[model samples]
Each structure stands twice: as structure tokens, then as C-alpha cells.
Target: MTVFVLVSGLFTGPHVWQETAARLTAAGCEVRAVPLGGLGRIDGLDGLDGLDGLDGLDGKVSDPGAVTDLESHISDVVAVIDSVGGARGEEIVLVGHDYGIHPVLGAADRRARSVARIVYLDSGMPQDGVPALAAVPDQLLREQVMLLAAEAGKGAAAELPPPSREEWRLWGSVAGVPDEALDRLTALAEPQPLGTLLQPLRLTGAVTSVPFAGVLCTGSGSSIALVQARVDFGEPAFQALADPRVTFFELSTGHWPMLSSPAELVRTLLDAAAGRGHRLTPANAAGPPAHLRPFPLDVPEAPVERIGRVDLHLPSGDRPRPAVVLVHGGPVPAEARPTPREWPILTGYARYAAGRGMVGVTLDHRLHDVTDYGRAAADVVDAVERVRADPRVDADRIALWFFSGSGPLTASWLAAPPSWLRCLAANYPIMAPLPAWGRLGSAFHPAEAIAHAGDLPVVLVRAGLEVAEIAATVEEFLDAAKEHGANIEVVDVPDGHHTFETVDPTDATREAVRRAVRTVLGHLTA
Candidate 1:
């Protein structure tokens, strides 16, 4: 007797959930796909004819020019909930997809007593005071979208028009979607009210008491493993995701799961409501956290000097020596204990470089999330500038080595490497963001930037057992590097994982590390 209420994302309406709702009805579940206000009225589905009882929903806004904001949409969802006995003690499983989640949360906040569970379908956990525009995957496009919305809102009825067919990729991944479905999606897509994206979602903190579920769409870029990795980094926000009340399920489809895999989405929804989805393990549940694990290599420690936020491991010599800047990877939690520069693996490599008569440098950067790549890159630039100016380091023959998630930082250097830059290296790096990151354009894609790396010696230490998404990015970079004839060398660790130095400590991994170090040093000394 559980009633399920569905809410669709931006530029979409209840019609988008028609196929999924039909399947859910066949499964003996009562389904109500709430047609949100401000998304315009659905006339009819051309290819999908004879679907009865679709038009003339109670709260749908018929006039496209009517002024509507987030409150109107929230009220629309609340109306549907109250209609279906939600206000009369009936338990309801409320589901929200993409921008639809905003209104769903707002409504759930008001009707917390009746909501059995709140489901986040392929969307970020929207926080209080943060608008939906802030959830746009690409950082650069987020700014532009907000700026355009602000400028357009001065008119009578401010609305941001839906993206064209070709422009849909900018909003979310369109993979696995059929041509007809895309056509329907574009045709029925409505102009979203600016208030929906610009106005912040206000919550009364009542919904936190309700159970939650997450339906992650892997084809669009997020997965259980990635979420776990972020949680392992001790991000306070992500820690809440590991709560036992929050369940998770992954769908191997695009952003619009209801369109690409309706039956599968329906099945997963049933499973989620039953609390049968995967439960994330708390950080340090098995043993000590990955960062605190011992280093794989036993290199002799070198004299270390801390200057501001940068650490310099100097070799035994007064003469100026070639330097190697080790840039650590992250979207690491800002409050992670010991910090990235202090991690044993980073320090191990820094000392190893110092033992080989080079000044090894490491610095903490503010790469707190995927969107902070711009800030992290600037911090790296500043650190490198300071290292080059050091009297104890050779300014003309410096090397830059990146690790893990910091891989995308190589784009700027590869596109226009300085004459004094000797070599570039990356160890198990993420060359590109996952598809779920939306079209980041070309700003952070090293796979595309490698085309411009003319004659710069590049060393890549690849992990054979790396995560599938990360491994795919490496292959993409390699292919692009080959096509452009860039000077690149590969040092493969066949049995190693992404953070192989500590996670998969073996002789093979240690040797791979040594080989990569030797290659970079050769270029620095050449």
C-alpha cells in the first residue's frame, strides 16, 4: 500500500516518466508522476500515443509566459502529495530526479511525518542556501549559466530556455538515449523558470530524520567506488552518506534512466524502498585509513625544510641542484589529518628524489572538489615559481610530477611547456573528469591538451588494476598522445591499483616507482 510520487528534473515534466510509471503500475505499485509548475504543460507525446490520463494535471502551468518560481513548484508537489493521502497518515516514497529533487526536498521538508523515504536519483545532495545552479557539473559553465539567468531575470517573466539537441550534452550525459527519445525530450522540453535555478532551496532540517536512498547512474560518471573513495578521504559531508539509513543502487545507463532503462529504474526503485541496496562502509572500517598505511618503498630520509606551505627535501650538497616538484592529487577533504604533503607515500617519493641528488618539493593545494581544479592549478603555479627562485635549486632544469587526481593539472603545462621545463610525469592520474561531470568543455581535459605537448618528455606510471573510469581516461590520454606524436614513455604496474604505492604494496609497484623516478631524473640531468 506504499504510494510512490515521482518528480522530474529541469527542462522536463511528468511525461518524461511515463514509461517508468507504466512499469511501476504493472508491478502493483501506485504511481503518481507529478507534473511540476513552470515546466510548461505537456501537449501530447507524438510517438507515445494513447497513454491515457496524461494531460491537464492539477498544478501544471499552461501559459509559458506566466511568472513561476521555486515556491510554486514546491506547492505543486505538495498538492500531489496531499491528493494521494500523504497528509492523512499514508506512507509515501518520494523520488526526485535532477532539478526535480529541489522541489521534492522542499515538499518533503513540510510533510516529513508522511514521507517514508526520500530518494536522490542521479543528483547531488542539495544543501540549504545553495541553489540548483550551483549543482551544474562544470564549474565554468555554472558561472555563465548564473550570469545569463541574472541578466534575463530583469524582464517580465524570467525563464531560461531549454538547451537545443546539440547543446543537451552541456547539461548532462545523453549516452544510451535513443534518437526518438532525444527528439521527444527536446520537443517537450520547457523553458525553466529562472527562480527554480537561482533561488536557494530552504529546508527546516526535518527531512534528516527520514531514511534516504541514492540511485547513481554510472554511464553518466558516478559510481559506488568513487563515492566510497571520497568518503574514505574523510570529507565530513560525505561521511553522512555512509549512514545506515542511506542506501545506494547503481544503474548502468545515462542521466535519464527512466527514458533509457525504464524497467531497470523501476526495479531498482522497488529494491531501494525495501532497504535492499548497497550500504557504504564507514571510513577506517577494515583497518587504518589508506593514507596512514606504510609506504611501499624504504628510501633513506633526506634533510627537510618547511617553507610556508611547501616542503623541500634537499640532497647533501651546497651546489644548486635540479629540482622535481611532486604535486599530490585530491579533491581531498580540507580537514584530512596529516594533509596530502605529509602523507608517507608523497614524502617517500620526495626523499627518494632527494637521495638521487635532486631537490624534492611537495606542497598542499586546495583541490577540495572537482570544481576546485582552477584553484589547485594556481597554487601549483605559485609553488613552482617559488621553487624555481630558490638559490639551492637549478631554475633552468625543473621537472613537474603529478599524482592521482591531480592529473588534469597537467593540461596547462602540456599545452604550453616552458623552455626551462625539463620533463613531466604522472602516476596513476585522472586525465579527464568522468562523464557525470558534464561537458567541462576543454578546460581540464589533459587528453586533449596532450596534442600540444611538442617534444616535452612525459613519463606515465600506469596502474593495471586502476578503477575502470580512471583507467579509461588514461587510455584516452595515451591514444591522444600517440596520435599527436608526443614524447611519452609508459611505466606499467600490471598488478597495481590507483593508489598502488600503499594500497597494493609489492615489489612490482616499488620497481615501477623507481623506474619512473629514474626516467624523470634522466631528463632533468640531460
Candidate 2:
């Protein structure tokens, strides 16, 4: 039984961790909800002014604002650890959310041997030798934070106060939250000690030895991608985003998953506690439809006639590895692509392939027009040719993995294959055109193409829970391919939806998807 320490971010107290803590406690784990210095307490605020609007403490204002500092919070956490027996006490999992990470790290640095794991929940990891405020590249947001702190206090001990319901919603943490959690957050939130953010973290590199896991809120964007983008834009605070030790996972919710999706958050924390972190795969990039997580690709994107681009993902090795060209699904909703590169679900397979010691290439082709199958097919060919030209790719061993709508695009290539082409993989593919989607030309017939496919091997995966129309189409394609004497393999995934693996919400579905991925990769590389 592991002991769990739950810490909340600025302006929030243990109340914010109520749901998570309760769930953990019920799961037979010892739970401690720690409210850092000055939080959930009225004594520290007695010296600060500007509290007339804060739950009626007009006369309880304090001056000098120096009551709480970073050391105070560190002491608070260390005390909790010691009370439970410190390093010799119990197996402890320290979990921090948002700004709470500062003290969490401070405590971990102090009690490194005592902590079994540290989970960063939608927060930045403190870099050594840098003040938290100094790491903020956005001058305007930094200024706003400081100004809020000043407005809540007197002298140099200024602190930040609770945001209004509207302000909190604007911060993107209120989305998908229940009324109960939302109200509690707005009413119980206390002003935070600013010194925690102003102080530079002290480290002897001891905390690096402790296991670290990051639970990212994908409704906003991927923490890894965001950090990498910041690193590219020259932000030092986010340098640890690429740190190999911090295993990353995604929760398709707002930043406050504890309030928005408490059960899922509980499960994720338990996984981290048990030293079962999310694998560093592209699947960590999965999220809500409009906002999928972004990952750093190994190779640059190749522009394809303003329609889309091709992204290359490479495995680590000295010898050239076989390449897998990945084609993502059909046209996503327009609102989903606020940016051109934000298309959903292509990068995961690339990352998975790379994880399996192979080069993965994912491309974005124009599928916005229902009638533009020709252009989409051409894009696949172009992506393949370009990948085959890469020096690091085994030119003679390139394969293809077509997903969903892009599955049918393999028809042209399958009809008359190149000698170097090894095999083909399709997942929940759309082999025949539906009347609702578009009209198919004579050349797009799966049976006709399979008869001419010769000895080229193909692997088809069917999802059990898929809609009737798609299920029938895949079934018909399988029968036709077999009738044409095409060498083919079919893997059926029960209880899996069309995009079950990518937009995963259950363990069973995710496992099924993983099995399909393994089967596809195995057959393709065979």
C-alpha cells in the first residue's frame, strides 16, 4: 500500500484534491492532502490588504505580506513526510498540480530517498538554478501574475488570489467540470503565497533519481509539444519536456482533470504510483477531436502542393531501418485544425513504429473535398517516393500502413506494385466508397485491384463496434480479396470502435488497439 501526497496549485487548497484523495483512500491507500503555507489558513492573510471582496475578511487584512515564503511550504511538505516516517516511514507517491510543483520538487529534493515517484499534473518541472518567474517567456502574462499578487497584498510579500468563476473558466480549467467541483473551486480558493513562484529552486540533482511522470491535459495542447515549441522559441523553463525520465500521458480534458474527470485522474495517478508510466509513444498524443496532442517529429515536414505535409519519424540506431509510410484518416472537421499541423491521429503510429526500431513516416494529404480521392491517392504515392529516397531508410524494405479513409488509397499501388514494396497494413479501413462520402471511380474497386495485386501481402483489421455500413464494407472487401486469391490476413478487434485506439477512453479498447498495432507491424515487417 503506497502513501499518496496530494498537493494543489495556486489559490487552491486540499479541497481541490478532495475527489482524487477520496478515490485513493477508498482504494486502500493512505492519503494526505497537504495545503502549503498560507493556504486554507487565515493567519497569513491578516497582514495583507485588499480582502474586502474575498469571502468577507475586510478587517482581517495584513500588511508587509511577508508572512509566508517558499521555505514555509517546503517545511509543510517535509513535516508531512516526517510524520509518516520520512524515508523509512512508507512508500510515498508525491503528486502535484499546476503551481504546486514548486514545493513538491522542493520536498522531493529534501526527501529524495523517501519518495517512490513524483507526478507532475499539468505543471512545469522546476529547472535547477532558475527562478520560476524568470522562466516565463511571456512578459505580459508574467506581469499580470505579479500585478495580481501585488493587488492582493502589501509590501514585497504580494500574493495571487482566487480567480472568479469567469476568470477560472477563461483559464480553461473549468471546462467539463461538474457544478459541485466548480462551485467549491470558486468559493474555497485562497490567495497563494507569491514567494513560491518568485523563489529559485535549489537542487543537488537528487530528485532526478526519483521516478517522474507527466499527466498532460490534451484539451489545450500536448505538454511535450508545447515545451518543445517553447524550447525552439528559446524558453529555458521547458527544457525538461524532452527529458527521457519523465514518461508522458494524456487526459482528454481541461487542465483541472481532478475536477473535470476525477475517476480517470485517480486511475492515472495509481498507475504512476505503481511505477507504470505511460510509454513514450505517439499514442500519448491522443486527445479530444479538435485538440490532439502534438509530438516532436525526427525529420522535417515536406510541403505537398499546399494541400498538406509529410512528417518523418526515425528510430535510434546506426544501421538503416525499414521505413513505414503512415497515412492518417480522411478530412477532419475544419474547427479541429485551428492550425495546419494540428490534424488528429497521424503521429502516434509513427512514434509506435519508431519505438519498434523502425522508421515511421506520417503524411497529411488534402481530403477536405469528398470527391478528391484522386488527389489523396497521389499524395500517398508522393509521400512513399520521398521516404524511399531518404538515406537512413532501407529503400528496398519500405511498407505502408493506411488508416480509415486513407485505406482505399492503397488500390492504385496495390494494382501495380513496385518491386521494392514489401507489404501493406490497413486498420478499420474504408475500402469502398460510401455514397455519403463520395463517388468511387472504376479503378477504386478492391476486388479488381486485389486480383492484379499479384503476390503482395495485405493485412486488414476490422473493428467490432464499428457502424453497420463500415462493417459490411470491410466484410465484403475481405470476401472479395479471398476470392481473388490475394495473399491476405485479417485481424478482428472485438469491442473496438473505428478510432478506438487513438481516442481511447477505456483500458480494454486501448489493449485491443495495441494488439492490432502489434499484429499490423509484425505482418508488415515479416
Candidate 3:
């Protein structure tokens, strides 16, 4: 007679809850898996079901905002509760993961009379009026997020960025959402509503009166590094639930548990449904998480500041090309050069650019000393000035190609962007300072660069999975340029992230990346 209503976390739909639901059902419990609005395949363009489903809804979709906002999600939870009515609602175990706690609790409050118990799978409890983002503990990411919000300023309500075509692809593989349903999920995904994130939650007494339990994943659920650990550890949430009213299970898994450990995960859910408090002790727990994706990091170079020199990695055919100042991330010196041939990626990008007859330059900026992204940006601007003053640079042919933070810094420096060297190519650019993700984008909110857009052409590239909830930042930057009547082109990279990479990226994926860069270059020449 009891039904179980399950809610998934951010960026996920009801489909992910299927395995657990099926397991619970086999144990004789009725189940209702509810999909959240922005992530599910049924609605919007950024969902997992397919892109076609959300295509017609593009331009009509709303933002996803931050995870703490409960008002919006209340409706998502209530819809399923309403459908189940009185009889089944009485026996429901309302469960949620990660950000799913908000809606699941909100729904139980609204439908208090019909609900049974609430379970959080390593998800933080959504305190009334408290924000979900406030719980994140990563210092660098938090710093970057605050900077983005401050930069966004009054534009907070504007559209967020959409995940690049590549990002969605990567997320599916990493999250175990399956490639077949990727396009639809991406199309259904929406820019989170900023106000919802900022708004305080005031739960009606009815919600807390319901029974509840929680399982917290102590590791990566709190930071990006932890999320990355999933590549090898799988979902860690299931390994830590130890309570009886709510069983706590800890697995050495990644954030996306269902994708990596569905079988053990299913058994746990079923045990909970059967009042068994299922937990994996020493013998039966899932194995360590495994991440097959490869992530690349740029080696630190010497610092450059004021009017001094820096090292930047721009692939323009020949290295040490005569007469070019370079810009780089962190502090790297000219002597700290990394052999291009050694890094297959740098090699590929370099070969492509040089084959197209582009000159190369590299530079570095002061970031280690500065405690904030804004100061770091100033360093980038100074480096560019140095490049301009140098007689070696063919000012007419200067093209700025960068990813992440450098994109906004370079774009901001242009005043009357010449059609040639004035061209801008950026991927996963830190164009907007996102409040929700804290300091993640603080170093280079594209809005800061808007002053110079009138002088040049700008293009933006976004990684699907890496941007995650902060996808809207890209849109705000593009909107500023279009507002100034500047020409702009936007490309969505499939299976892409902060860096230019795919999950086990194949030659085809590499070719796709190459074509994208070349297209941007060709457009500038045109």
C-alpha cells in the first residue's frame, strides 16, 4: 500500500532513479521516479532524452539558478505526489540525492498528510531560507563564484550559458546517462534561475514533521576534485549512511552513483524499502570508482606583472617564432617552455594553426601573488599591452586564441577590434562571474570585457559537463556583445569540458575540435 516517490539531484532526470525504483518495486514497494525540470529529457533543450524534444522549447526555457531554491522544485515534487493521491502517498519514502533534497522535502511538506519518510543520499539538508551553494567548501571555486556574481551585478536575472555540444556528451559518459539519450537531455537543460538560488527558503512546518534520513558522501560531493575522483572511485555517497530511521551507506564511488554502481546501489534501495537498512560492510560493497577520462594540466611558469614579460601558449606553427611576446596561466618563464611535440594536443592545435599560416606567441601573468581573479585579469591586460608595444608583433595579424580566464581578459583589451588580429577565439571562457558557483568565473567575467567588443569580433566555446550549473555565464557575455552590436559566433562543443577534451576522445572527436578552431580562424579571414 506504500508508494515511494524518488527525486534525483541536479542535472539528472527520473531515468537515473529507475534501477533503484525497480529494485524497490521487486520488494513489493510502489515507486514514482520524478524528473526535475532543467535536467530531465521531457522538457527544455539541455535534457538527456534527446535534443529534438527540447528544440522547440528553446528561447522559451527558463534558467536553473542554484540548487537551494525550493519554491520552484516544490512544484516538481508536488506534481508526482498529486498524481499518486491519498492512498499511495501514505506509504511513500521520498528520497533525493545531492540538490534533490530541496524539492523532495518541499513536496513532503505540501503533501504532509500523504507522505511517509524522507531519505537523503549524501545530499545536504535544505534548511529553510538557506542556500544550497553556501554549503560548497572549495576555496578556489568559491572565490571564482563570488567574483562572477559581483560582475554579473544587476544582470543576475539574465540568461545563463548553455552547455556546449561537447560538454553534454562528456557529462553523459561520466554520469553514465548513456550516449543515446544525450542530445535530448542537453536540449532540455535550462539556465538555472538566479533568483531561485538567491531566494531564502521558509519551509512550512508540515515539511519537517515528516520522517527523514540522510547519507553524506564526505569526499568530492563538496568540491570539483571530489567530483573528479569519481573517474576512479565511483559514487561515494552510498558508502556512508549509518542511521536506522534512515540508513547510512558509504561507497567509494563518484557523484553519479547509479551510472557506476547500479547493482549494489539497487540492493541498498531495496533494503531500505523493505525496512532492512541495507549497508555494505567489508565483503559486499562496490569496488573503487574508476574514471577513464584523461585531464591535462598546464605546467606553472614564472610570474609576470606590471610591464614585465610572461609566457603564454599560443600554437602558431613554429615555436620561438621571431618577435612575439607570449601569455600563460600562472607564472611560467620563457625558460620553462614545454615542448609542443610532447603534448599531442598542443601539437595538434599548433599543426593546424601553422598549416593555416598563423604566427605563434606565448605569455604568462601574475596570479599566484594575487588573491583574486580581478587582479589576475589586470595582469593579463598588462601582458597584452606589452605584446602590442613590441615591434615584433604584426599588429594587423594578431589573433587572440585562449580558453577559460584569458578569454575575457583578451576580449576586454580590444577597443576598436581590427578585423584580423582583432579576432577572438575562446573556449570555456570565464566571461561572466557566476554567483552560484562562487569564484569559478571571477577571474574573467566577459562583461568586464564588453567595453572593447565594439572594436573586434568575438566567439565563445563552452564545455558541456565542466560548466554544469554555471552554463549561463557564457550567454551573459554574448548578450553584452550583441547589445553593443558586435558580430559574434557561438559554437557548442560536444563531449567537451573546461579544457579541450572528450571522454576517451577519438580521432573523430579530435577532428571535430580541429574543424571548430579552423572555422573560427577562417571566419576572421573572411
Candidate 4:
């Protein structure tokens, strides 16, 4: 019989894995659902003031955060393996979900001789030196998480509180589970210590020898979002999933498959533990392709300067087609690697344009800060000229599509777009510079550029849950453009969040994106 050890994510205890554990045990497997210290049933230090986060625990005692760092969790797992009689070569299978992957990987590294395989269940994989928080692509979101942790624990320690019921519904969990499962999950959930997340897993690259498996929940928005972010940022976290030694499978459910699809989850887990699962490929892990034969742009510009290239996605054609350039959101992170510009959201839109019989162009530009605005505009102009130069492209018909922070940079094109350019479109754009946002202090308003944008045709896509300042500025621009008699179209996504097309995509949001693209392409052809 196989010995299976399971670890849970943030704010969750071993109880979260009860159903799955029971099923595994019924299958004649020995299971140990190990709970991390400070997260479950820790004894002794309970009555200490400011330790209210540990209110429900009823076990032995120790200094919680002080003693329960990364090494402590590793010790807990190693202890379990020792108790279970795990032996070299016939080592046990270790499974981790969500944030639990960190400590699990650490334990596997230390006890490599006693572990046969490591399973990452829709969890973010750890990079050798990049800590969990730093591994997250979105810096703003990272800051917000830390702030919430500090507030929840009354500055006593860095620990995240369980999500409120409403947050669960909006973010992901509610869509995957029955009412009872959700009730139990939330009830048993506890605040996860910050040290686990803050401490970087130190790996010596020797862990690659252990077999690995990943379970991707295709239906979960959070899973899709994390995978997309990792692929785009070229984080090693995504690369780990693609490692040759790793075998992966997909489940059509949400994040908590243990509760949502326990039976199927168990089957996949067993197959993985036995080294009998399918090999995951890029095609299987990612969304469907946008084009059958998209070509990489590698044109050279003045002074042998190879203009930053983009992927040229061609529509079915015996003749030339109109084109649309897709610009993604940014202040791109400084750590982002030099990679191909094929982010799903960008290519997703490009694919939509191809479906509508228009050639699509997705640009690659390096953006480090506010100063990159001028270079961004220049890149757009160069991209247009390069695409126009293509024999398959109609030089006289072109358009631009912008998302998030990149939207404001379109002001230059709108101000003086080429004769071949038809219009520009934006989605939940950060058009006006808010110096108060602090990245670029008070000296970076592009109001004059925006004022000049009134001369061009434009499509504005709005997501309902925007900050007040962004909404107000976008509305102001729309009002002014209307007064200037600019031809404009508006698409409203009332129930959508910013980046809803990826973060928490809905049928409605997808359609809204398509409508915006169609509207822009229609202007170009007209």
C-alpha cells in the first residue's frame, strides 16, 4: 500500500482534506493529513494577548511564529515520514495544495531519499530563490496582501485571515462547492502564519531528481489567472510545471478539488503517485491557439536597430486583410525576462480579430516606468509601419487596441494617427496619470495628449469595479471627446472587475471584449 501525505493551503487545516483522505484510506492507502504549526491545534501560548488569531486551536504549545518557520514545517513532514516507515527508493508520495506547495517542496528537498513524488494541486510552484510574495507577478496585489495580514493580526504577526463569504463567492471557491462543503471549509479555515510565505525555500537544484505531478483545475478562474501571469512573466514557477520529470493532469472543477471533486481528485492523485499519469504539454496547459500559423516579427529598423518584434497573426486569406495592434497593460515589472510576446489575453484578442477576418499584431515593448510613455508611442508607430509593410496586410486599414495602463499611451496615436489608421480602443484603461498613485509623483499628466485624442474615432470598454478616480477621469475624457464630435463607441461590463477577461472571466465579459474588438475592426474596414 502507498503512503500518501497531504498538505493544505492558507487558512485551511487537515480537515479540509478529510473527504479525500478517507477515500484514499478506503483504497488501502495510508494517509497522513499533516497540519502546519500556528495554523492548527497549537498548544501553550494561546492565552497570550494579540494571539487571538489562534483562538480555535486545542493542542500542545510552543512559540507560534518564532518556532514555526519554514524549517519547522519541513520537520513536521519529515517526522510523519519517519513514523510511517517510509524507506529509500519505495518512498511515499507527498501532495500540496495552494500555498502549501512551498513547505512541501522544502520537505521533499530535505527528505529526498524518502519521497517518491511531489504533487502540486493547482498551487503556485516555488522558484529556487524567489519567495512566495515576490513570486507573485502583480506588485500592487502583493502590497495589498501584506497590508491585510498586518491589519488582521493587530500587528502582532504577519498572518492572513480566512476570506469572508462574499470574497469567496466573488474570487472563486463558491462556484466549485456545495453549500455544506463550503461551510465546513470556511469553518475549519484558520489564519496562516506570514513566515511561511515570507521565507524563501532554499533549494540546491537537487529536488529535480524527484518525480513531480501537477493537477490543474481548468474551471477555476484563480488557476487560469496564476498560470497566465507566470507564463507572461516567465517565472520559473510555471517552468516547474513543465519540467520533464513532472507528469500532470487536468480536472474540470475549481481550486479546492478536494472538496469539489474528491473522487476524481483521488483518482488523479493515485495515478500520479503510481507514476501512471499523462504528460502535460504547453498545448494542454494553455488556452486554444489564436492562429494556425502565426509568424514572429523580426524586422530591422534604422541603424541596424532591430525594432522590438511582435507576433503577426494572419486571418484566412488569398488577399490582404485589415490589421489591429494589441497593446497589453503595464508598468512592466523590471524583473520580467526577455521573452516572446504571446500572453493569452493579448493573443486572445488577436485571435478574435483573426476570426473576424482581420490580421492581428501583438506588440512587445519594455516598460519600466512613466518615462517609457514616449518610447511606447514610438513603438506603436513602428509596429504600424512594420505591419503595413507586410504583403498580407492592407497598409491603408489599421487599428489599435489597448488594455489597462497601456491605454493612456494611445493618446499620441489618437492625436495624430497615420492616414491608414482607422481608430483606437481601450479596456478599463488608466488614461489619466494619478500622481497620487505614487509611482510617478505629480509631474506626469498627459492631459494635453488626451485633449488632442478628440480628433480620432475611439471605443471605450469599462469594467464596473474601478477606483473612483480612474472612473472619473475616463468619464471626463469621454465627455470631452463627445463635445469635440469624435466618433466613439462604448461597451459597458457592469458586473466585471478590472482585467475580468482573465481574473474572473464570465461569458458576459468575454462577449464584451469581442464586441469592443469587432467595433474597432468595423471602424477600420469602414
TM-score of 3: 0.41
Model 4, position 68: C-alpha lDDT score: 60
lDDT of each: 0.85, 0.67, 0.50, 0.67
Candidate 1 ranges beyond 4 A from true positions: 46-51, 54-59, 62-66, 86-90, 439-443
lDDT of 1 by residue, 140-243 (tens): 66776677776776754466678899877777778788999999899889878788888899999998888989999987777887788778878887898889
User: TM-score: which is higher, 1 or 3?
Assistant: 1
Off by over 4 Å in 3: 18-28, 37-69, 88-90, 138-159, 162-188, 216-244, 278-526
lDDT of 2 by residue, 217-290 (tens): 76543344434333332233434544556676778777799889989999998887776654442222333332
Return the TM-score for each candidate structure. 0.93, 0.48, 0.41, 0.59
Candidate 3 residues 440-464, lDDT tens each? 3433456655766664666666666
Tell me how candidate 3 scores on lDDT: 0.50
Evaluated against the true structure, the overall lDDT of model 4 is 0.67
**Clash totals, every prediction:** 1, 5, 106, 3
| lDDT accuracy of residue 526 in candidate 4 | 82
